[model samples]
Structures are given as structure tokens and as C-alpha cells.
Target chain A: MQDRYVAYAIDITDPDDPRVDNFRNLTNADRRPDRPGGKGLVIGEGTIVVERMAGTRFSPTELLGVPRKLNELQAVLQDKNVPYFCASPEVMAKIVGFHLNRGVLAVSPRPAPLHYDSVLAGARTIAVLEGIGDHENLGALFRNAAALKVDGFLLGPRCSDPLYRRSVRVSMGHVLRIPYATIDDWGTALEALAKYDFHTVALTPQHPSDTLADTIAVPKVAFFLGAEGAGLSETALRAAHRRARIPMTPGVDSLNVATAGAIAFYERSRLTEQQAK
Target chain B: MQDRYVAYAIDITDPDDPRVDNFRNLTNADRRPDRPGGKGLVIGEGTIVVERMAGTRFSPTELLGVPRKLNELQAVLQDKNVPYFCASPEVMAKIVGFHLNRGVLAVSPRPAPLHYDSVLAGARTIAVLEGIGDHENLGALFRNAAALKVDGFLLGPRCSDPLYRRSVRVSMGHVLRIPYATIDDWGTALEALAKYDFHTVALTPQHPSDTLADTIAVPKVAFFLGAEGAGLSETALRAAHRRARIPMTPGVDSLNVATAGAIAFYERSRLTEQQAK
Candidate 1:
């Protein structure tokens, strides 16, 4: 099975093939953020994301695309026995129930989500978001998290499903690359952060707060952010070890929560770079 | 005209009422990027955004909402002659072609765009975007520009209309507050910026470039950002006085254009603050 290049190039002509059942009802299947079962599959669109999927822990079990993308992705499929279901863009659209301009898509079964302890075991910097109900924001937070080298993400109450189609697209598929887990217990689950020697900093606009620049000194840290309009619950804010602010202009609502998170992550990276120097 | 505060509120039972014509086609109005009159009007949704619209230079000619929102907006409209066309939520939904959960909407005629010289005259820092065709990215850039204290925006080729509805909403109505204009002459516009003593910097991820942290000496600067996928044109990058990067992790595409812009704005702000101290 691990010999030379080989991909089962299945020609899919029928839109209603049961083999492609998981890919149907895509519009509704990708909605419903609250149901865990609704978000079981990790989707990768386009050749780059598919290639990335091939290399990551999340292996692509099925590839659905026009022949052009199949040829484009052949180099990356050399080692895998994955099925490449070639179909016309029209047939592919009918099977997926929508037009996918990316021209190709791959699907991965969900692996066990990384456990909190395992994710935080040796992490120096992390991001925790609460009530970030918007898929784009959640996706952006992951992109920023990956760019700034945050070790992982901790999702709190009311976060949208990270595996949703819009999120995967907006995140440029980074949601799959960056690890995350839920923390419904708020402070109690957050207290475990302290056990990892992480200084949990609550990012807020209120006073009695240190600027992000001033608070990046802790060796291990986790910056907490809430949704943009309805921010962190008071309990979540009070439970953090320190209160930090990004030092914004007066009268402006805080930067979009993900933008604020990017700044925090950048500041933390600055500390790591400085130490290395 | 000043005494119009006591005017009777009109009830609109019909969705197709001509008086509410400015609010029609919420979806298609903002579709085109190149045409001058593609979008119908500057739209502001929700109370906070509506209030911002009232406070800004964009004048709201008509409003559609439930009576409760009318009550909430009383302070902002106390003296305006404009009629608040109060309707039941159902009627309002029919008029707008959808149920606007914000429960209120305001439409403003586009104001004469600010002259480049006038908008640039007193600015210490500015943002320039090229080919940022996504309405959400354009809007979120304004939101970040506002929060980070970037004084103004300069639009280059292929950028979407900043006053488009989704852009306005995503910017939290900051699109109305921040002044922006299209630059027709490309690199020639860099000369006008030079007259204002702006240190023009092009943001790119390419190496052998100055890091954003290293480009902080100039008190007045203009930062250039490209669209998400197709970044700055070669001519745009070449015309800039300098080039800089935000220092991202390996194997990641550049940050979302707005996120990258925010980080650049943050770097500029941090430098300015440090110098002030």
C-alpha cells in the first residue's frame, strides 16, 4: 500500500451516491454550531488546504473535485491511498449541494480534540476566547493564533463551531492546524491554567488594567478575550490572574476581539524573540 | 424646520411604499466594486450604528424602525426634520425584504467625498489599501483603523466601496466616521503624500524587507495594504518609499489584510507612544 504513487480515481457521475453521503445537505450540515455531531468532519478546500491536510494528523479520506484539481493535487497524493473522486464541476456542485469555487475539496474525519491538559502541558503562550459566537471571528482568532505562534486555543461558552464551512474558509483552514478545546466551567476549568504555571490575563477595556506591553513578561501566559459586543462574563474576567488592555483610543469600542487577540499574541511573541536575543 | 420634532410619525403598512425606496435591495445595492453608483445608500443598522450615523457627517434622510427603537433614538433625532417612519416589526421586515434583527435602520445620502489634500492635511498617520475587494475586509479595516488611531484611509485599485452596507455594519459604522478616497494615479499619488511629509511604507511578506518594528522613526507615515489573496501590485510596492513585513510564522499565508493592517497600526501607535514618553 505504501509503494509508488497511487490514488483511487473514482469517477462519480451520480449526485446521489451514498459513498458521498457525508458531503450532502452541506448548507444545513454545516450550520447548527451547538450540536457536536453536526461538526464531526474537518473540511479542506482548494489544493493548498488539501495538500496541508495530506501532511497533517488529519488525513484526507476523500477528495472531490474536477479533473483539473485532481491533476494539480497528484504530486501531494503520492504516498496516500486516498480516494480521488473526479467529477465534472457541475456534478460535484450537485453532490455538495452548492457551487464551490475552490474547484476541489477534501474531507477528514474528526480526530479526538486535544485535551486541555495535553494542549497546555508545556505551552508558554495561549489564547482563550469566550462567547465568540461569530464563525469568522473564531476563524480569524485561529489564524492570528497560528501566525503569532500561540501554543493552542481554549474556547469558552457560546463559541461557534470551528469546523463550520465558513470558519474553515475564513481561517484559510488554520482552524484545523491550531489545537482547541472547550472550557464550560469558566473559572474552575480556567484555574487549571494556573496549575500549568500560566498567568491568565483577562483582556478588557476597563481601568486598573496594565497595557499589553507591560503584561507580556510572565513566562507562561494565556490571554482571554470575549465576544466583541458582549465581552467576557464578569466571573471569567475576575477569575483571571491579571487584567490587561491593548491601550486603544478613547470612545472606540475595543478593537474587534480577534484584532485585540492578534496584538496580544504579537506582544507575547516579542517577549520570546527578545529572550532568544 | 427646527420645530419638526413634534411632527406626527407616519405608519407604513405596505412594503413597496416609495417613501422607503432608499432601503430597498439590501443585498444587491453593494454588489459592484467599480461603478460609481453601484450601491444605493449608506446604511446603518442597530441603535448604536444609527446613533453613530447621526453623529457623523453622513446625514440620515429617512429612518425605518419599530417604536421602541424610535424611543431609543430620540436623543439623536430630537431636532432633525426627517420623519421616523414607525412600523410594526412585521411591516418593517416586509419593507426591508428581511427581518432585520437590529430592529432599526437608517439610510444616509452619500456626502461629497473628502478631498485627498484636505483629508491628508492634518493626518499624522494614514492607511492605504489596494485591491481589498471584500466588503467585510474593507469595513473591518476601517474599524481597526479607528481603534488604532490611524487618521484616514486611501483606496487604491480594485477596492470595494467603503460605504457598502455590510462594510458599514462590520465597521460598526466607522466607515461613516473615517474619510477615504480612491487614488486614480497610483504611484503619482505618492507624490501628494510626500508633500505632506508622509513616509510611505508598503506592507509585504517578502524577505529582505524592514520589519514593522524597525520602521518606526517617521512621525508621519502611510501604510499600504493589499487585498487578501492578490496582494499589492508590483507597481504599488515599488512606488512606496520603503517596504516592511509583520514577521509571521512559516507555512502560513499572510494574515487577513485587516489583521495585518491592525498589527501595523499597533506598531506605529506603540512607537509614537514610546517617543511621547
Candidate 2:
């Protein structure tokens, strides 16, 4: 029987070493895994996110950190045979092209994308996102979804890659754990969801007939969210089964996209828990 | 009566002009209004925030922007006699030490602080913040407070000043509109709150007996929130009349401070509206 616990610790004093090229120049836009010219690496930062990535299906291919963080992650690293590249903070910062105060980073290749049908198979409540282009907001939405009991995320259009470095950090690494898939066609996606008996709720501030709390008691539900200023596209809104609004003060502009989603998810959780009781 | 509609449009071509000194070096830490050895100037950015400042007690003492923003703000500027300093975007960017895409900026002298008693008076729903030192979270809390009909905010220990430039921008200038007062003594503040018959509910993740929805129905309610990782202090938890929590999925960490506060505020709004209906 092969041993599951394999530890390979490599100490690299040189910042320009090719062995650590995967962790280089992280701030450059072209280095983003989702971009055409970029290496499609899933980067996780900080101890918590790094630990989470180790536990997820996307195993870290390599890690670069100061001695302290490497020691902290020793337990999680024990089971994996990945190389742990130990370097001083200065060398690590030089290699990454920024002062990464988190003192730790792990990089992995993107995992196989989850199928929409699989994500929906046993899901009770989900978030269907359209045009959530901001990485921080997208990550925050995933965090909210995880905390509020939404089962998964279904990306419709214009959503940034959830595995992006900033998203991973901002989400507290929740993006790695929460299952997600992208839809090529909104119309077909809605039709597919309807066939699965999911009630699609489009959240909008404009002319919403029902409050989100009123619409959250369904057996299967998906709340659709949009970008900050433009909101959900008309086609996406029309495709949903129902429209709901989180009641707001009359003169104030709409809530931030993620905050609005959190309210919807919270309401769903509250209602479903009450019903269960 | 002295004319209130005086328009002083100054076109300064030099970045080092002393007249626009107040808007200079915005990114420098020493320029922070809340920091020691800093000029105590409240700065507002973008058209929306500047417009909101015009509508709030924090009146802009001076304004700087491109011609486009100047034209857009004409209606708001008509009633105020403050100097409107217009410059080219390039020149304005040099003066502010960054390429501020917002295209507009406003500066005001800090207003006299609000009294805690005044903030609590006539308020039905309020947020009491402890150790919310993050400027973005502090600002987002104010924005959420404004949207969800929270009447005011009471600052406990270690809360950042909402009037700081980053907070002002993040709050969408809602911090200028929301009434807030600092509490020198938490014990006395609690006593004062009790005199007004406000239910002091501390939101904690540890062993909360009642859910937020269960406690939000009071005539007057105050939700206490702590910083992100370190929740409400032990002193704060004991100081509250009751402890309530937002139920979460097991094994997940607590929600972001601002998001948690928003959920609590949303529940309060929902319950109050339901009762009113």
C-alpha cells in the first residue's frame, strides 16, 4: 500500500528559480488563470485559505511561504506529496512582485468545472449570478452563499473567475468549497431549471411585486443577481419565474450586490428553518 | 440677506497651488483626518458622494473636479457659497496624488460631533459598533444602516471614524447622512439606552439562545456588532440585555461584520413592516 502521508520540503534561496515560476508576478493582469495569456493556476493566500485549498478537490501543486506558515500548515501538508518551497519573506515578496503580508501562498491548476445538472441535482437553494464582474463582490457572494446555506452558484454571464487570487482571499476561501458551474445559454438554463422544479427568483429594485421574504418559502429556489450599476439584464430577468425585492428606504439607491444577495439567502434560510421546525 | 448663491469658480493650472492644498496628497497616511499630526478635513469623492455631502450636515467648504462634474453639480452648488475649483482631469489627478476616476472631490471641515443622547433620542433601530476598525466595513455598515431604515449609529470602543475619506467613499456618503455618536463609557451608554427602553441585543456566534428574528420585534432595538475575527467583546456580551445570533451553517466562520449587521437590520425592518401592515 502507498503511503498517503508524504512530505517534500524544498528550501530555495534564489527568487528567480524556475522551480517557483508559478508563484511569480501575481499582480500582473495577464497572469490571471482566466485570461488568455495566463497560466490557469488557482492561487490561495493566507493560512486559512491555504488550509482550505489543501482540503478541497483542487490540491495545491506547490506552496511558497515563510518558515512559520509552513510549520503551521504542516499537518495539512502531511497527507500530500507536494513540494513545500520554504523561502524568507523578502525572497517570497520579490518573487510574487508585491508585499504579501499573509506570508503564505499556494497554487493549483483549475479543477474540472462542475456540471450545472450536478450542482442542481440535490440543491434546495442556489444563487444564479449574471454580470458579477467584480472579483471581491463575487467572492463575497460565495461567502454569503456558504454561510446562509445556499447549496451552489450557477454563473450565467460576465462573472469573473471565482478561483482568481483576490476572490479566493476575499471569500475567506469559501469559493473553493462551494460548488459552481457556468451556463452558456440563459434561456436554456432557465428551461432546464424549470424542468427540475426550481423556482427562479430574480432580485431587482425596480417594480418588484413581491418581497424576497414572501417568495423564499418554495421547495427549490434560485435567486438571480446582477452587476452593481446595470443590474440583471432584461433577458435574464424575463427568464426568471418570479421577481422579488428587498424592501429599502425610498430615496436610497440599491444595496450592494453581495449585501442584497446575503439578505435574500438569509431570508431563505430563516424561512426554511422555520418550516422545518 | 447675504447672497447664498455666490459661485466662485477658480481655475488653477498649477498642481502645487496653495488654494487647492486641502485636496493634495490624499493617499498619504499623514493626511488622514483621524490620524495624529493630520489635517482634520473630511473628504468626499465622486458626484454621488459630493451630492450627498451637499444634502448632509457636512457641507463642502471647497470643491475640485473636471468641467463635466462641475456642470452636473450646478444644481447643488447653486444654493451654497463654497468655492468651486475646476481643473483638467490630468491636473486634478496630479494634485490629489492619484488618478481618481471619480472626476470630482469635495472637502469639508469636520462637523461638531453628535451627542450620544441625541443620537438615541427618537431612534427606533440603531447599530452599536465595537472594534470595527476597518474603514471599508465601517463605511459599508453605515450604507447598510441607511438602506435598511436604521435611524442612527452609536460608536463604542475601537470603531474607526466614519468621516475618513475611504469611509466616506465606501459608505456612498451615507455616513455623512447617518447620525452617529461616540460612547465614552459603555456602561453609562447601556444605562442611557435602557432609560429609553431600547432592547440592547449583542450579536455573537457563541451559544446564542435566541435568533435575531426572535429578538428584532421590539419597539426600539439596538444591534451590537464586533470586528470580523474577534466577535463582540466579553464585556460587550455581558453588557447587553440579551444576546442574539444569526443562525449559520455549522463549521463556517461568522459573516463579515457589515453583512451580519445588515442581516440584523433587515430582520428588524421586515418585522416592523410586517407589524405595520
Candidate 3:
């Protein structure tokens, strides 16, 4: 039988300890994933995200939290020999440079990014994002992808790092759960998607186009979404096999990109479920 | 012919003028719509939101911006004769307490909150929210509502004020575009909703209930969503006429309540569109 007790579960009294250095000044520049020289470590806050991180490609190398969190993760920590740097709330806050309402944080090195071809290989319904600079929007999109059972994500140009700390926090850590890859070739990646039989549908409100529901029955599809205000580039939109609209009342501006993606993903999922039934 | 000239436009060089105090420290306590001493002013940032506010119930009482934004709104500003508190970018930033990237700001008092009965009356589909304290999510939901054509919004207990600055900013000013009201009596409001022949559809993943597509055909429906972490409270859930779920993968937490609402609203809109066809 495996030894149920964990030796690495050390109670830390000092916030200055080097053991939890990976978590220091978390909200500041040195830890900012998009910044140069930043480690871009995969951080999981709270038990749920930590538990989720445990099951993903990004494995936690260290855990920092209150003792209660250690108790909660005891079952998940049974096999790992990684250090659990448990501390008081004050100590943890001092180490992290802010009060963490989630009470625990797990830090992991980012795994290698997936190749565009590899991520697109099995995805039946994928979200292709362009210039989505907001970390929360990027994270929220990942959360939506995971919940709606979207196959994966494709990163377009000008998009922010999905593994950034704020993205990880806002996505409720679904950024760790979903697979994503950057598209360096921009519109050229449309050819790769087409080769895989994905109907590249550009989501835009520019002029009359097919409504989202009309695109549901298409066998396999990828919705290309641009940043909220300035949508897909003309080159990118031209690359798409088709264009679709969310069908709004005449005068309102388009929906936020993530919200639009959610509706698109939901439509695709509905079709798949209906087909299954 | 109307004598059209730029002479009516006054460009100011000062930031501390009392005329612009309504737009000062905007992201703070006194400007908060929910604060006790809060003036409950609805603020619009950027040319787009400013244009929207021009036609919304929250009429702009004061306008502050750079030359570019003032020029963009010149036609809309023609007849209003409102104070165009113009400034250079540097001065505008000092007044608003931040670098105004959107380049313009319009301040308006909150329109009277809609009557609970009035917003719901004659509505084919709407959304009811409870304990949704996150302003961004609330704002995103309104943006989604505008896109998906959800008729209006009904707020239950503990929901944050939708007119909060962050919500307005995150919603891209859709809060000004959509009509919404607070339901003070909690579950008793469900009875009033029923009187309007509305089916109160609780959006929860817990129940192995009807899928959203299956229920979208209901003539009059109100989709109820709760906060992100804790879903619909027992009272909110029990008060629902039916529980409908978006089909999602097992063990995954439900989609963000606002995203879920978008899907439900989109589903209803799609159904209505199909019937119209």
C-alpha cells in the first residue's frame, strides 16, 4: 500500500523562505506571463483549480496554502513528492504580496505549447481567437470551451498569453484544462483547418450573413473571433470559408467576443447533441 | 438650412472646473451607483457608448472629451445644447483620475429603475439573475442580452447594481441600451412573473432536466441565473417553473451564469426566428 502520509507537507512560519519564492510578488511584473524574463508558471488558486491542475499536463511542482487546503488536497497529494509549503494566511499573503481569498496556490511550469496541426487534429468545434488582449476574456473563453465541450482553441495574432496569472485566475483555471496553440501563419492557418475539414466560419456583424443557427449543421467548424471592437482583419475574414452573424436587433453593437464565442460554441454543441440523440 | 459650424464647440484647458466634477474620481465610492451617498450617475466612455447614451434613458448631463471624440459626436450634439466640457488628453486624464484611453466620457443620472411588472410585461423571453455580484459578468450579460435579443433583465436578491462603472465599461455600455429592474421581494416576484404568462426557467446543471433547445419553444420564458460559484439558491430554483440545462460534459462546473444566459437567450431567439420563417 502507498504511504498515506506526505513528508513534503512542511508548515512554513516565515514568508521570506526561499522555498515559496516561485509564488512571491505574484501580481507584479516578475510573474507576469506576458512580460519578458517572466516564468509564466501555471498557477492554480483554491482547491478546485489545484485539483484540476493535478489532472492536467501542467503538474504542480509546489503548493502554497493554509493547512486546511493541505487537508483537502491530501488525497490528490498522496502520489506527489512535491513540497506543500503550508503557512498562515498572513505568511501566505506576505509571500504572494497580496491576500489570496482562494487561500491556496499551486505553481507549475507551462508545458510546451501544442502545434496548430496537433490541436486542430481532433477538434470538431474549435474557437480561433484574434487580438483578444484581455486576460479575463481569454480565460473566460477557455472556461466556456471546457464547459461547452469545445475540442480546443487556436490562438491568432495579438492574443495575450493564455497561461498568464490573471487569465488562469479568471478562467477559473480552465486555461489549464483546455488545449491551445498559437497560429503564427495568421490567415495561412485557414488552409490547415480546411485540410482537416473544418468549415472556417468568421464571426462578424459586417453586413448580412448567415445566422449562427444556420451554421450548426456543418459537419466540423471553427469560429474565428476577433477582438471586441475591431473584429477580424479583412485578410483573416477573407481566409474564412464563410461569415456569420449573431442576429442582433438593428442598432446594437456586436456582442463581446467571448460571449459571442459562447453562443457559437453552444450552437455547435447543440447540433452535436442532437445528432447523438 | 441649419447653420452648421464648429463655433458651438468649446475646448477647455482646465481640469478642476466644478462643471466637470460630475465626471471626477469616476471609478470611486461617490460615483458608485450602489453607494449610500452615490449620485448613481451612469457614465459612458468612448465615442460608441457616448453615441448610445445619446438615445438611452440615461441622458448625458455632461460631456468631457478630446477633440477627436467631440468631432465624432458633433452631429449628435447639435440640438442638445449640453455642456461639452472639452479638454486635451492630459487635462481629461487629470479630471477623470486616469488616462482616458477611450478619449471621452459622458456622465448621466440613473434613469428610474423600471417597474418589475413593466419590464416583464409583454416580454417573450427575459433573464432573471440572483446574487450575481460581479459587475463585469453583469455587464457582459447585458451585452449578450442586446446581441441575443433577450427582452429585459430582472435582478433578484444580492445582485450588484448593474449601473456600476465596471459593468458599464465591461458591457461596452449595453447596460444603457437594455432595460432592467430589481426584484426586491425575491421569490414572490416569481408570482408576478407568472401573472405575465412567463415560464420561469431556472438555468442549472444539477437537474437531469430538459435541455435548453427542448424548452426554447415556450411562448414566454424568463431564464434565471445565479452567481458564478453558487448557482441558483433553493428559493430561486424552487420558484422556477422548470429547470433547463445547457448540455455540457460531465464533472465540469456549469458555464458562467451570464454565458449560460446568452445561450438560453440565443436558443429562444433562434426558435422564434425559425417560427417566424
Candidate 4:
């Protein structure tokens, strides 16, 4: 019987080695093909994210790290045959164009895009994002969604690519684990959700008739969230079946969009638990 | 009667001018006298925070900004007698050690520290921090607390200074408006909260027998939260009247401490709204 996981360790001392080009200048946005302005590979940082990548459908084609990180990830890589380029901390930093304190990185080609229907197949709770252009917010939203049992995400128009490097890192590699799809046609997406019996709740700070807690007791919920300052566009808000608010103080500004989403997700989880009880 | 609000603009082109010294080297941690390690001034950046400072008890002794921001903030600074040290963007950037795109700043001497009793006075909901040493998290927690109507903050041992520049910026200047105090003795502080008829709930990911929603109905509630990775210490957990959790998925790590606190705060607000209805 052949071993299922095999890690080929290659030691490269040279910073300019062509073999390590995939890991070069990771901080440079222009180098990332996955970003809106650039064309580069998807990259994962640190041992934990690398381990997650190994388990996800988005398989890492290559890895670069120091010996310690390699040792830390040995168990995760045991069955999967992947090239692990091991280098000294100094050499690794020089090659990556930054001092990566995480000390390990995994690079994977973009996978085939998941369809909205495929991602929503069995999801009872879903998050819909519009114009969430900030990478950090996008990542944190994914992290919150996963922790709160939000089954999947559907990106509306103007949202940033979740596969962006910063988003991947901020999501703590959960972006690779949770399935997501882009909604090219907002109206069609809403129609599909409605057809699936989803209670489409638009989260807005302005003119919300219902509080988030009041809207969570449903069979299936799809929350529509927008960026912090310019909340859900009029078109997006009109498309939803209901409008819900998190219920905040009168004078204070709305909560951070990611935090607001987490609160909504938590409310949904709480309602579900109560129902079970 | 003379108008109480007046803006005194002093044009400063020289970065070395002594009048603008308080805003100099804004990014250098070593120069901050307000921090544990340094003796510097409390700084507020951008027009919104400056406006907040003008309204708060921590009165800005001096302010610096560009002409455009000065015009935008005229109403807020109209009654305050604080000197507005106007400067060109280039000079301001050179003095502050970076390009402050906000184009405005205000510096205030650390005001007399508020006693825990004073901060807790007339407060129905409050957040307590233990071992929350991160500036960004501390700031975000304050922002969430304010927006969610958590009236005050009580800092336990090992908590970072909420007035730090990064924290102030991250809080969108809410730290200035929200009153907080340091807990010299956790035991006494807990006793004080009890004396004031407040239910002290310690937020912990481990051994939490109750969910947050179950514990929010008391006349007053004080939520005790710890740092992200370490969570609430055993001593802190044992000190509280109850241990509560945010109810997350099984396999994922606990939510970010600030996010967890926001959820807890939101739950408290939700329960309060239900009671009112």
C-alpha cells in the first residue's frame, strides 16, 4: 500500500531562486493575481492556515517555511504529497519580500468558482454581502459566519474577492473551508432565495421596522449586509423581504459591519438553541 | 455677554515650533507620557474625535489642523476656548511623524482619573476588562460598548491604556466620551458592584454553564471579559456571580474578545428591549 501523504522537503538557500517565485513579495498587492488589481496565486500564511489548506478543497500546490514550521505541520502533510520548500528564517524573509513572523506560507492556484446553488444547497443560514470592499472586514465576517454556524456566504455586487491574501489570513484560513459564491444578478439571487423559502432580512441602520432578534425565528434566514458607512443600497434593501436592525443607542453611529453581522449571527444561533430546547 | 466658544488659529509652518510640540512624533511609543512606559499627552486625531474631545471632560488644551478641517469643526469648537494650532498639511505631517490624512488633531493632558464608583453611577450596563492588553481590541470594545449602550467600563489588572493613540483612533474617539476607571482591587471592585445591585457576569469560553442571553435581565449587569487567546483567568471567573458564554460552534476557536463582548452587550440590549415592550 502506498503512503497517502508524502512531503518532499527541498532546502533552497538562494533568495532569487525561480522555484520560490510563488512566495515572493507577498505584501505587494500588485503581485497577487487573486486581487482585483493584480494576477497572482492564492497564498496562506502560518502553520495553522497551511494545515487548514491541506484539509480544504483548495489544495496548496506548494509551501515555503522554516524547519520549525515544517515540523509543526508534519502530521497534516504526512499523507498529502506536496513540495515543502524549507529555508532559514533569513532566507525565507528575503524570498518573501517581508519578514513573515508566521514563518510558513502555502500557495495554491484558484479553484473553480462555486455556484450560488451549489453553496446554498443545504445551508439553512446564509450571509449576503454588498460593497464590503475592506479585506479585513470581509475576512472577519467569514470567521464570524463559520463560528456562528452560518452555512455559507453569497457575495452581492461590489464585494471584494474573499480569496484575497489579507482576507484569507484574517479569516484564519476559514475562507478556504467555508463555501462562497458571487451573485452576479442580485434580483435573480433574491428570487432563488425566496423560492428556497428563505426569509431574506436586510440589516440596515436606517428605517428598520423590526429588530434582529425578532427576525431570527425562521426556518431559513439569509442576512443581507452592506459596508459600514454606506449601508445597504436602496435596491438591495428593496429586494429583501424584511428589514432588521441590531437595536443600538440613538446618538451613536452604527456598529462595525462585521461586528453587526456577528451580532445577527449570534441572535440566529441563540434562537435556534432556544427552539431546540 | 462674550461668546463662550472661540477658535484661536495660530499658523505654524516650522515643524520645530514649541507650540506644536504636543503633537510631535505622534507615532513614537517612547514619547507617549500617557502610556505606562512614557510620559506624553493624550492625542485625538480627525475632526470627529476632536469634536468629541471638545464635548468630553478631557478638554483639549491645544488643537492642530488644516484649514478645511478647521472649517468643518468650527461649530464644535466655537464655544470651546481651546487654541486651534492651524498648520499646513506638510508641516503638520512632518511634526506628527506621518501624513495624517484626517488633517486634524487635538491633544489633552490626562484628566483626573475617574473613580470606579463615579463611572458606574447611574449605569445599567457596563463592560469590565481583565488582561485585555491589546490597544486595538480595547478600542473596538469601547466602540461596541458605547454603540450598544453599555454605560461604562471597569479595567482589571493587565489591561492596556484605553487612551492610547491607536485605541483612541480605533474607537472613533468614543473612548473620550465613555467614562472608565481602573480596578485597583478586583475583590473590592466586585464587592462594590454587588453593593450597587449589579449582577457581575464573567465571560468565559470554558466551563460556562449559562449563555449570555440567560443572564441579562438584572437591574444592572457588568460583563467581565478577558483577552482573546487567554480568556478569563480562573481567579477572575471564580470572582464573578456567574459564568456565561456567547455560544459558538464546537470546533472553532472562541470569537475575538471584542466581538464576543459586543455579542454579549447586544444580548443585554435585546433583553432590555423585550422587557420594555
Q: Compared with the true structure, what per-residue lDDT tens digits does model 1 show for residues B1-277?
A: 3333332467888878898777766766643434675545678999989899987888777888887788788778877788788888888878777888998888887777777887789999999888898989899999998899899988877777888889999899898988877786686578778889999999998776887877757889999899877888898889888899876788788888899999989888888888889
Ranking by TM-score: 2, 4, 1, 3
DockQ of each: 0.70, 0.85, 0.73, 0.88
- Top candidate on TM-score is 2
lDDT of 3 by residue, A109-202 (tens): 8787888787888778898899999998898899888888888888888898888878888788788888888886675677778778988898
**Compared with the true structure, what per-residue lDDT tens digits does model 2 show for residues B1-277?**
5432245788979999999999998998666555697887899999999989887789898999887788788778887888888899999999999999999999988878998788889999999999999999999999999999999998988888788889988999999998999885688778878878899999988895588888778899988899999998889999887899787898898899999999998999988889999
RMSD of each: 3.2, 2.9, 3.2, 2.8
- Compare candidates 1 and 2 on TM-score and give the better one: 2
C-alpha TM-scores of all predictions:
0.93, 0.96, 0.90, 0.96
**Model 2 chain A — which ten-residue stretch has the worst lDDT?**
A1-10
Deviating ranges (above 4 Å) for candidate 2: A1-6, A33-36, B1-6, B32-36
Give the clashing residue pairs of candidate 2, or none. Answer: none
Q: For residues B168-257, could you state the per-residue lDDT of candidate 3 as single tens digits?
A: 887878888777888876656777787788888888888767888776687898888988779989988888878898988888888887
Per-residue lDDT tens digits for candidate 4, residues B1-277, read 6432268888898999998877888788865555476755788988878888887886788888887787888788887777888788999999999998999988888877898889888999998899989999999999999899899999988998888999999999999899999985688778778877889899887864698877778899999999998888888888888889877889887899889999999999889989998
**Is model 1 an incorrect, acceptable, medium or high docking prediction?**
medium
- The local lDDT score (0 to 100) that residue B56 gets in candidate 4 is 80
Worst 10 residues of 2 chain B by lDDT: B1-10
